[model samples]
Target: MKLVEVLHMNGGIGDISYANNSLVQRKAILMTKPIIEQAIRDLYCSLLPKNLCIADLGCSSGANTFLVVSELTKTIEKERKKHGFQSPEFHYLFNDLPSNDFNTIFQSLGEFEHDLRKQFGEGFGPCFFSGVSGSFYTRLFSSKSLHFVHSSYSVHWLSQVPNLIEKNKGNIYMSSTSPPSVIKAYYKQYEKDFSIFLKYRSEELMKGGKMVLTFLGRESEDPSSKEGCYIWELLGIALNELVIEGLIEEEKVDSFNIPNYTASPAEVKYLVDKEGSFTINKLETTRVHWNYASNTNNENIYNNGGYNLSRAIRAVAEPLLVSQFDPKLMDLVFQKYEEIVSDCMSKEKTEFINVTVSMTRNN
Candidate 1:
């Protein structure tokens, strides 16, 4: 599939939209806030640019999109007040695939700006906002134009599916059944795409500019570990149920693949060193339960976790599923998905491994 055309979070403010189901992503942003704050402070102090240029790559439209904006501005505002320095003018850019819901984000700008001014007061930034539609794998900004860059729950998405995935039949992502060659192909594609991502960002960032990135990754050296792949495995099982019911073609399930990868910390470090553009200041990993209430004593909410998890996954994965399956069958698919996920969660612990790294553009 053409990822640029097919890959995007479900848009708008409806029940199934990403805007409503992105609590998991929001938790990740908050988890990495300390690193982001330090990156912004270091960049601002080093150069003290009057106009601070910031870009949020893979900034899919949602309340989560501006969550990053609030974090950055909050950090800067505190820094300025601490030093008694005048506030800097902020130029913010939000980027995503051209098919993203930029219109929804645009419509909400009035309230967003109003809230920022009211909270930060008169000395607060005159922050300018705009959208750039394109792939981050290619050049998206002028050379040395950006001062601080932030991307969350992105960069794990490959620019395209692996060319050799024909052998990866029966499963949509890396699984225990996948051949050794199929696993290697996934890693190779990630290596190539991530290298280019660093290369382009290095070109766009001013020297000493800082970046904070967070995305899905695996803690185990083994690529097929359940920590990272089980979510998709449960998804694959749901699709197979549809195939058995004759609702979906068996061949379609055999041919379709998710154009995403979860990397290990060792693998990420290897590519960063090989790319030769940035210094890795902090590389840390944290795990988030697929069901946020998994640890709570509330059995009712915990039991309903599967239904909630299904909605969250659907909001993000529906766009890709629709491209290959009948749109009308989506609800049926997730209903099966929720049943399987709820059953699995009751027996085992399931979570997403999030990797957050802070880097500096080397001179």
Candidate 2:
């Protein structure tokens, strides 16, 4: 499917991660960065020469790309120093959907160009950087070329619409009362997407290459629970408001469903085991706390991460706020959402809001 169509169809309406300025997101990155570096080091140590070709899939625009590269480079440098060997050359490729904001990523890289050059030095090694735009589940690189692959906040996304949902005649995934058929349809799509992801990665990564990935996931095996996902609830509220305002027909809203799915850690393990390409080096889920507003004093929403809540909702909300709702009405809607969610936040009193998993590729 086309990028916009895929996003609209699947409910990937928000940014894949929280807003960049979120302190909670920054903290999560800081906590995760070291682990990622350690994984790269372990993988690099297993390989001779230490020259690594790394790819970050679904690396959307902004500082995230630089964050991964910075961690990888520094780790390699430290390892080189410890071994008393010359630093290996680095080939860093960033991949995302064609519709993503590449200009933003390019601009961020430009800002860091001088610093990167100074660190690597001209003619020091074959350091290559390129942006490859395409679906992660499709061909984007030569076979057996990548040494390490990293994707964060990606892969939970399906490459296409769910088949069962279509066959079910609109009974599933419509509202808070999604039927079993709807849930099955969602899983079916996830299965397909994940299978394609494994196959693609298996083809692109060389023997013994490693992959580290982090995405939104469920802790529970049960699919019907609403505990972990706030995006669906928020979307339901937004659609209800839109219907009440007569901006969109109730039938149209009912026909639409979020095109995203989350798997439990066990379910993810199952997929990997079944695929037989990647081995589970380490798989653990940790709560990631994210905050959108800078004013932490506001007790309405404490943590704002996972299920791509802040970014995904803003993607849909910002455009609708501009085109569909009047300025005053949009302001009121935002306020109402905050008011409704604030009490829940206080009641829950939980801060962390993410699920992270890491893995490796087997020869």
Candidate 3:
């Protein structure tokens, strides 16, 4: 599959839209807020640019998109007040795949701006917001233009599906049953994609600029550990059941694979060191439950943990699934998936290991 064309979060503010189903990602952002604040403070103190150019890579639409912006601005304003520095202009560039829902993000900017004014008052930055359409794997900004970079719950996505996966039939990701070769292929792809990511970001950021990124990762060295790959294992079981029912072609399941990887902390450190661009500041993992939002006000809407988790996964995975399977069968597919996920949740505390890394460009 052409990942750049097919990969994107489900758009709009509807029931299954990413905007509504992204509480898990929201939690990750909040978890990494202190890291982000420190990065911004360090970057601002080093260069003190009058106009701070920041990029939120893989910035899909919705409240989560704005949440990152709000965090950065508030921290900078507080620092400026404490240090008695002149007010700095803020330039934000929101980037994602070419097919991302730029319209939704643009439509909400007016209210976002008004809120910034009301909250920060005279200390508020005269912030400028623009949408850049393209992949972060490639260069999107001029060299040495960006001052700070922030991405949460992104960057684990590989640029393309890994090769040499014919042995991975009946599975969608690096599941426990996947052959060793299949596991090797996925990690090799991640190493290549992440190295390229570091190289390009290093060029875009000014010397000493800081970055903070959070994404799905595993603490275990084993690539097929349940902490990293069990979610896909359950999804595979759901799809195999559909195949048994003859709702979709068996060959379709065999050929379908997700273009995402969950790297271990060691794997990430190795690539960053090999890339020779950025100095690692902090690397740590935190666990987030699969159905973290079920206890919120929307609890009645979800009613069950299985349904809550299913909607969250569907918001992120539907676009890729629809490209290969019949879009009409999505509701049925996810219903089966909910049953599987819920059943597993009852027996264990299913959680995702999220890795948050803070880094700075080398002088």
Clashes of each: 0, 11, 0
The TM-scores of all predictions, comma-separated, are 0.97, 0.82, 0.97
lDDT of each: 0.90, 0.63, 0.90
Q: What is the C-alpha RMSD of each candidate to the true structure, in Å?
A: 1.7, 4.8, 1.5
Flag the better candidate by TM-score, 2 or 3. 3
- Candidate 2 weakest lDDT stretch, 10 residues: 8-17
Write the residue-wise lDDT of candidate 2 on 24-93 in tens digits.
4345556677668878888778884546799999776555567778878878777777876777888889
Any runs in candidate 3 off by more than 4 Å, and if so which? 295-303
TM-score of 2: 0.82
Please provide, for model 1 over 49-151, each residue's C-alpha lDDT reduced to its tens digit, 9 standing for 90 to 100: 8899999999998899999999899888888899998999999999999989999999999999999999999888688998999999999999999999999
lDDT of 2 at 345: 52
Model 3: worst 10 consecutive residues (lDDT sum): 293-302
